[model samples]
Target: MTWQRPASVPVGQVWSRFKGRERDGQPAKMSNWERYIAQGVSLACFTETDGAPDELVAFNITLDLVDVFTLYGVDRYLTSSGLTVLPEHRGQNIGARLFEARKPLCAALGIQCTATVFTATASQVLASKCGYTQLAELSYSHMAARGVDLSGCATPTAKLMGTKFHFD
Candidate 1:
């Protein structure tokens, strides 16, 4: 099923839910969720309501990425950073559907979409499966030197991926 985000959901509600959940035996930190929301990025969570016991299984957070676009000497680009799904709800295609929802959004906004897939995360596979082209691959050590923490990540490298519907 495609992603379904309720209009009434709140970030705090989801943050609480992810707090005690484990990804690779490491419980997801509430700080991560808070930082994602505090960045003032747009966020959406996927709710599986097609059957009984509807639930929030996944989420996607997008930013305008104006700064990055400027660095590239262009504009009209979006960057999606938080692509998360509950561990218990994974392998059900929730991540793919959430990622797919961005296609129409990009078309409507006339912007290209980009995101990153970290090693050992389902996002690496999900990004490819959702038709995002691999743009670059950077090792964790390189990212760490840039002041970004990679301790929690399981992958050796993080891949940047992109999808576009317009040339200009």
Candidate 2:
């Protein structure tokens, strides 16, 4: 149950090759792939790593400014694109913990948090656990209109959820 804390992102694929050739024979000093390494303010986790603690996550994020408001609108917020815990990690409440981790990062910038997920109780439960309320639920066919491509989705519906927060 050892979780490797967040650290600088590993040298990226493009950069790794650059370093490989530049420092021939010398290994690149990169960060470990596990536990829940935070790169900047990204809400992410690694469920698999090299000999590292079983990093757990099936999540994606969108940092673009979501137009979730019209009156008294805000600019940007952390979007939890998806959070699918591995089958083995089910019932562990990892999603809740991960979402909890995202709060402060947003609060520091005075921004709210949002998420979109299918009707599945799992994700809805996670969102609820994180204090987000459902704003709407859309059909999978409409995903493309919302800039979603569900060819990779396991379900047909994803709910839009959000919550207000402050640093104080």
Candidate 3:
């Protein structure tokens, strides 16, 4: 299926539905969602119809300011951060599809690096499968400023840097 980047607000709503709780354990604030979507540089994924009883599968692409500055001397680099598929949609290639769709955009943007922090084993596996290498295992507190949960989540981040492009 073809993928497109929705406006950040709508993408945030989709993100909120999958992420469930905020770091504070409260229902996620709309502002946080808005922030994430706004911070996201690009997106490649599909959204299911509202009230369709189906899962919405999508991959969110973001640019990390810090990493971009450190590695590329810029404040932006492509990142595939949020990959969510409804339970029923598991085993399908939705995630891969999202990645494939986003790859070209990254290339066009001259994005030679990508980074992401993952808390789930499945996410780690997916990252490796998608050609990202485990670069660091750091404390979640490092990501706290981003509104992520430090205590409950184990932060595993991966990266694909330099002039390498692998789209599968």
Candidate 4:
């Protein structure tokens, strides 16, 4: 899990080499299309070494919600940039804690709702546990017809999930 792309490896060579790698019966890496959507404000958790953060263990990025204004009836909701936890840190509830932290963040940003397209079943489950409800669902096959291929994913379908945050 401590991956360092060696100088000899091409820019994406390491990723390409392990593109089909699976963990816990699911693909460990995301498709390039999904990677394109992962850019935005990042929230991260790091492990301390000598009382200073030394390694990023988990992270979730937030971006302005897009194309789903009609679904939530708002144009300014927060959405996922992407969420990831180091493979070594998996199964430790770190991902759930990150989602829980978003509530306070949303309130501070004056954003009332949050939404995301959960391309993995595990993420959809986590979203549900975080109180997000399914707003829509699309099959990977359907997405492929539109020019984005998500055929080799763990789940046949992806879900659009959303939730409203209450600020005191």
Candidate 5:
């Protein structure tokens, strides 16, 4: 079945300004998350709770990375904008289920590929288990060299994982 966002749930946006040595202390790059949400889709996992029948446990937002993938000979693909699983829901396989669900969603949408930047070690492992191949990797120390201090972060590296769906 095709998915449609509920009308009652409005998509929100936030503007991010990047400044530092990477940008030479200038606003070289800016991002609006809502724009991505508007242009793409979000998948969520919910559970029944004592207080709330439908409690959000996990979610993943994806956006089309046509511009970035074109150079690689990929016409279009869904690139993860964000992914999260509630702390209390961790270890329940909800995140893995969410990652797995993307296949049917992509087939329904006529999209052939999906990709994500897995910054957490657990997520990278999950992606590997889900059949996503590592396309590239970026280490936190490398980011620090580029002036982005990701020191003290629990994740030491980020990997770009992608898969091409073979819909039946």
Candidate 6:
């Protein structure tokens, strides 16, 4: 399979499908969507066969951030977001293939790749398999905001952490 970043492809189609279902009660904010389109590039993986859209099994969004500077000599953090494989295409290692295609794109942009996964079992497994590490675990005060009970949980807030993969 080969992956290419085509400028004419409709990235919003895949992004809306994945993100709309993930976040409830709100359309993906248009401003954020625009920013993503401006700051990120979309990759599509396809088979060699002609007219084989079905073989176009995976999609990813890689965001480039060059405005922030850190001591590690890193200026960009490439985020891998909205990774989705067709339902019939699961268990085929397509996700890993899609990620492998992204490495060169990150290097070309001079960015350190990272992704954030919520406290979900599947996400944690996939992120770890993709070479991401757990940088920090965070807690939130849900009761104060959402007025919900989180007695058994350590904290109502979700975890937010950073992970890095270097291509050099």
| Among all candidates shown, the one with the greatest TM-score | 4
Encode model 3's per-residue lDDT on 3-51: one tens digit a residue. Answer: 3343422333222222221122222112233355555445533433574
Provide the overall lDDT of each model, using Cα atoms, as 2-decimal numbers: 0.57, 0.52, 0.50, 0.66, 0.65, 0.50
Give stretches of model 5 more than 4 Å off: 1-40, 48-53, 68-73
Instruction: State TM-scores per candidate.
Output: 0.62, 0.56, 0.53, 0.71, 0.69, 0.56
- 1-168 per-residue lDDT for model 2 (tens digits): 332223433322111000001112322222443333343344544433363423324343434354546432665555644465555444656566666656665554456654555456677767877788887888778877878777566667778787766555
Could you tell me the lDDT of residue 39 within candidate 1? 39
Error of 1 at 19 (Å): 26
TM-score for predicted model 5 compared with the true structure: 0.69
Candidate 4 Cα misplacement greater than 4 A, ranges: 1-40, 66-73
Model 3: lDDT of residue 57: 42
| Candidate 1 lDDT trough over 10 residues, lowest sum | 14-23
Better of 2 and 4 by TM-score: 4
Model 1, TM vs. native: 0.62
Could you tell me which 10 consecutive residues in candidate 4 have the lowest summed lDDT?
A: 12-21
Candidate 3, TM-score vs. the true structure? 0.53
Q: Which 10 consecutive residues of model 3 have the lowest summed lDDT?
A: 21-30
Q: Write the per-residue lDDT of candidate 6 for residues 2-54, one digit (tens) a residue.
A: 33334554343222112112212321212233343454466554433353333
Checking candidate 2 for backbone clashes, the offending pairs are: 47-55, 117-158, 117-159
